[model samples]
Target chain A: MRITQGAFSFLPDLTDEQISRQVQYCLGKGWAVNIEFTDDPHPRNNFWEMWGLPMFDLRDAAGVMMELNECRKVYGDRYIRMSAFDSSHGWESLRLSFIVNRPKDEPGFRLERHEVDGRNIRYTTTSYAVDRPEGQRYR
Target chain B: MDLDVVPMTGNVNLREELEAVGIEEILTQLDRELIGLKPVKTRIREIASLLLIERIRKRMGLTSEVPTLHMSFTGNPGTGKTTVALRIASILHRLGFVRRGQVVSVTRDELVGQYIGHTAPKTKEILKKAMGGVLFIDEAYYLHRPDNERDYGQEAIEILLQVMESQREDLVVILAGYGDRMEKFFGSNPGFRSRIAHHIDFPDYADDELLAIAELMLGDMNYRFSAAAREAFVRYITLRKAQPLFSNARSIRNALDRMRLRQASRLVADLDRVLSAEDIMSLEASDVLASRVFANGSSPANYG
Candidate 1:
């Protein structure tokens, strides 16, 4: 998967060794990680220049799932964010959905949307109870 | 394009040639070489190792692979920060981190073009030079401002952020400068801060370390120091040790060059004497006195 992830923090707060190890660890588990520049904020100062590399941007969704399985073996239950395409009518249109993995809820999280690529996207933004089908573990 | 397939079984020591050439020899020969910063070295090594692993796993069909990584270096002047960065580009190429590993270093002034609407192409031109390898920005702190500055360092920063994520598979970005100055630099722009996951620090060299480094410079040039000359050099260094502008290896070098010229002048009348290597190598009091080692402006900060 061509995976990308990003957020903000002063680059110096995290040593180069720490970040390289994390990138290595992520790659070792089958995730392609790119630490590139991003316009994120500093930890202490809300207004610092975005000087460091951002996060991972995954290209293929199904490929990401395979890697996510591998990731589970290493990261255990640690929260991971996933983005995948939702297509209809044989690739007529496509959009992406975001989800978090939980032990007891749905086997995986899926979001329904009017249009998958942009704003009309819906998500399970928080962890809460939902009604399940007859044999569902936790819907 | 590949019709013939061959089977391989043995491990090859890929860097035997580089190792044979000698790290010190290569360092000395380079147009610019910053010396002595172990922490920065170790960090670059870590990044190189990670890049190597990614390549191996991808070949075996076991990983999602990307081409290059983005990293930042933080340190003061004369800390050998830029020198290490260039070495990193070389090592990364050897290890297959980036395809070319050509390091294109620039400062904010080079990146942020003057006037409105001109900065994007300028930044892109720099990136073009840096394509297939590393783009190293010295004094990256200057790129971020409070939005009223005439320099388009911020616009360049934003455009760079988008390009970094888009073209990350082939390019690496390294932002470098003094530690405290960088903190203040980052404090000015939030958009420029978020993407960096790693930071490396280059600390200042100790006095004795700098002196030893100076001695090494002379040794490399096939010259040796006499007892008196060595003492005089050390005493001279001690006298200026507290000066805010004293250079590390570089200042010591300027001193030696001046001494060499002084010795040449003294030996002009004795050219027929057939001097031994020792006689020529051992620097004397006259050389030091005539040299500008005692000059007022012989410091690292004084140069650049």
Candidate 2:
């Protein structure tokens, strides 16, 4: 199963038009939109590689969509997401985040279990796609 | 007591009185109502002071970020965890933090949905109701069950984490359960662990504290224990404290309820005779002993 973790994971994946609407909503709130992509979709992986600096001065939704398209062209096989950052008082973190793209085939994680002492087990989750090299993953 | 009849100058004092009943007064009230758990009280006071100072700083334009109010209360059942969470809500409201000083107590069943595509909406609904107040999740460790592959509790927890972050300013989430189990629950969810700012441990009440709590409950109900009954209660609480399913203050409440039943039956047995006020209000030693026997499933051979 895909590790669905984000704002709108339970709903159907957003198309480019739906993504553009969300970007417009974020831009309407005076928030900066940024694109991010990563192979490791761990829930705690908060720092996804930034496609570029946050589109702070870009007020138009078309600007955000253009950048998002460029990011998808390069990292289309990886999980790409869009996040809106609110630099307002009392909140400096990402206010909204959602996955925009996923690999054609998502190879989910494998739960690695190790037996410790008596009746104790330690488990590690590793993404199966990451076992292959960067370009070969999700091929 | 009539506000209309009072002089205009009296309104000043009334306003002062209203202002006086703020966060500090709530803390004082919490201290008065709870019997023991000194450390728990102290931690709550610390949280109140921190929030108070933050408000002061924000007013002075010295700070911009609001402090996280999410907490974890680890202890056994009936050790005043829910009560403290309620008090925390009032404190936050009075201090101008949250809009409402209410506590919505829930367990795993209330947050987690039964099937797929149901957990997020259920959890979000609960969070929406808990906004501008405290969401007190009792036995929160049950929300994470790793052994059950079909359990949707983790989905509920994931929704909770997102809301806890997004709604930090208006809502406070208090996760409470047994100490060992809560520790294990935190161990499994590292993201959840990092978000919790305060961890208050409600230690089990000492024997004397339980007795005090029992007496307080009885007094509130216009009843008292006789001298011998007091001794009987102390013994009962001590024995029950060591047994399983012994929820400190809750056990006392149950025991008191049973004793009241026994006292009523005993009084009814002498229906023809005129009874004094003391006879009606006082619980006898036999009443306490009977409650103990009822709870333990047998007569205590050593109590006699």
Candidate 3:
């Protein structure tokens, strides 16, 4: 999906690196995003080109957000944000943004714990609010 | 084979009962997806618990006051209030709080009926439809306005109030609409306000959550987006974030449909001959974002 200031024009041939860079650029510029996706309204057969592109239909805003989720899962480390107007409410236009939050560890990593008490100073609690050593929860 | 056979003693066929009433099925379906509304989920669970307890009390033949069935669901459109109402109906039936588990959903027009004497039977008919389960009234605020001279919305409200009071044990009534509007409607009618005890608010889905929803929808349809396409879509979304008319999941679905449709149409354009599976399967990025579609559509430059 390619976005422009004027109208809905798509550059279908953009690559992963290009998309990633674009996302980075948009974030750097502090712009809002309207996520448009291929599965919205209806599914497209030509997903390769249509999968995660922005569109210019005020009616398709929901569809775009749905697609952005897919993009995050697929692209791994890439993300973007943009700003636009919503015509649904007939109200003043506002700016919105989208940014992807990814996990730090892709697979899994091991961490060493201190058993200073000798009898083992480890306890487990299901309540996430419980106080514990920073890295002890996963164990 | 061992000659000793063990007999099952407990009368509760939990799995069978669940299967018989479609509880497990609806649960599975609903559990598979829930977007950003944790408070709503907790309330639903609590209501479900209340219904379960009510059922147990009934089974023991204890003469206790019937559990209150009134609720006020506050949220914007596209919020899952309607969906949650339907599920609540099912859960009620499976737990034996109601007999049929049917949901008779209506708006003001449908409930108020047409003429003076006509309102009674019309409201009755709707109640009959909702008998044994839930009566979900969408945009219920419209019912409070007796001020509208020609409108029968007031009559419908009166009828609904009566039905809600009388049918407390048999049917569950849910009045849903915009939060602020509902509040005003309640303020206008003390009787209606007193009956409703539980209120749940559904919040709007954030951008990341919306993105996740889009992905889920596409993945379910077997569509995979390329990196460029995803970024492009996100870029568009970010540009529109501050706009008041933010599209929810429903809007996102519509956009995806149009994008895919445009892509599919491209393959058929050049074909004077039959199109192949391969040709039909792939959508080029340009095909999805055709300039013609957005020619008169929204743009950042003209958005202000």
Candidate 4:
């Protein structure tokens, strides 16, 4: 099963048009659109490598799409997401984030369990995709 | 010299009264009113201070994201969980976090529906009423019954999680129940656990604190225990603390009510005599003993 972590994971995958519309919505709200990709999709992995600087001056959705396309060209098999950063007074975090790309063959995760004292068991989940080095994760 | 009639001064500090009431005042009130649970009070203060700083940061145009306000209050019944939740609502309101400082308290009966299609609307309706304020769910562990497969409580919990996440800005949820049961409930629902930003444990009050709480309750009613009656109350509370259904303050309130009833009857019995003010206001040892006799099926000699 695909690692459903980001927003709109329960919904169907967004088409190019839907992604453009979402980018437009974020740009309309004066938020900067940014692209990030990661081979490790751990739920606690908050720091995904940024494709480039946030498109702060780009007011058009086309500019965001161009950048997203460039990011996909290099890390097509990695998890790529579009995030809108709100630098307003009350919010400096991502206002909106959703997965826009994922590898075709998701290796999923392995749940490792260690039996502790008595009935206690500690469990750790590790993504199998992380076993591979960067740029060769999918292959 | 009527001991029952305590005089109240009309003098008020103008500066203190005119000062903007803030979270500090609410915390002070909470500390003053609550009998014990020092840890709970400290945690609440920490949360309030963080919220205050967040509000200031927002005004300064600094980085400010409202942290999750949902909390878990684990303790026994009548330990003032609901009372603390009410005060927390006031604190959040005074800090400009919530619109209204009201608390809508509910149990599983109100949230879980009887039929399959009934839970969502029922829970949503309660959430709507609790919006712009605090939603206090007492005995929240009852909302999830894994033993019963047909139960609709899980549905209510799901709806609650959804609202707690989506309407976090407008609503604050406090889940309260027995400590172990609440721990189990959180273990079963990781989503619920993740949303709870604060975990406040309301410890059972000590014997001295319970005694103080009893005095406070009686004082509010203009009632006082005679010297011997006070000793009897301490003994009675110590004994009652070990019994079943020993709700800390609630049991004390019940015991006090029974004593008052006994005192009223005792006073009526001596109505022919001109009773002194103290006699009418005071609870004698006999009255306290009689209340205990009525509560436990034991003989009065056993109390003696």
Best prediction by lDDT = 4
Each predicted model: what fraction of the native A–B Cα contacts (within 8 Å) does it retain?
0.00, 0.00, 0.00, 0.00
Give one digit per residue, the lDDT tens place, for model 2 in B186-246.
9999888999999889898899999999999999999999999999888887777666677
- Which is better, 1 or 2, measured by lDDT? 2
Please give, for residues B268-297, the per-residue lDDT of candidate 4 as tens digits. 887688988998889999988775443656
Top-scoring candidate (TM-score): 2
User: Which candidate model has the greater lDDT, 2 or 4?
Assistant: 4
Which candidate do you rate higher for lDDT, 1 or 3?
A: 3
Under CAPRI classification, how is model 2 graded?
Answer: incorrect
lDDT of 4: 0.81
TM-score (C-alpha, index-matched) for candidate 1: 0.56
- TM for every model, in the order presented, reads 0.56, 0.63, 0.57, 0.63
Interface CA root-mean-square deviation for model 3: 16.8
Clashing pairs in 2: none
Q: Which rank order by lDDT, best down to worst?
A: 4, 2, 3, 1
User: Interface RMSDs of all predictions?
Assistant: 11.3, 15.0, 16.8, 17.0
Candidate 2 Cα outliers beyond 4 Å, as residue runs? A1-139, B1-21, B292-304
Look at candidate 4 and give me any clashing residue pairs.
none
For model 4 chain B, the run of ten residues with the poorest summed lDDT: B1-10
lDDT of 3 by residue, B1-304 (tens): 0012133333655455345545556555676687677788777767765654454445445535777778889987767788888887777767666655677789977777677777765665566456556889999988766577667777777877876787676567999998899889888888988888788898887878777777787787767555666655565455545545554666667667766887667756777868666445444456434523334455644432
Candidate 1 lDDT, B41-72, residue by residue in tens: 56655665565555445545565546436767
**Taking the tens digit of each residue's C-alpha lDDT, what string does model 2 give over A1-139?**
6769778888888888889779878977989888898987767677789986677744346556656776888888889998999999999989999999988888788899999999899999888887987677866
Name the lDDT value of residue B151 in candidate 1: 57
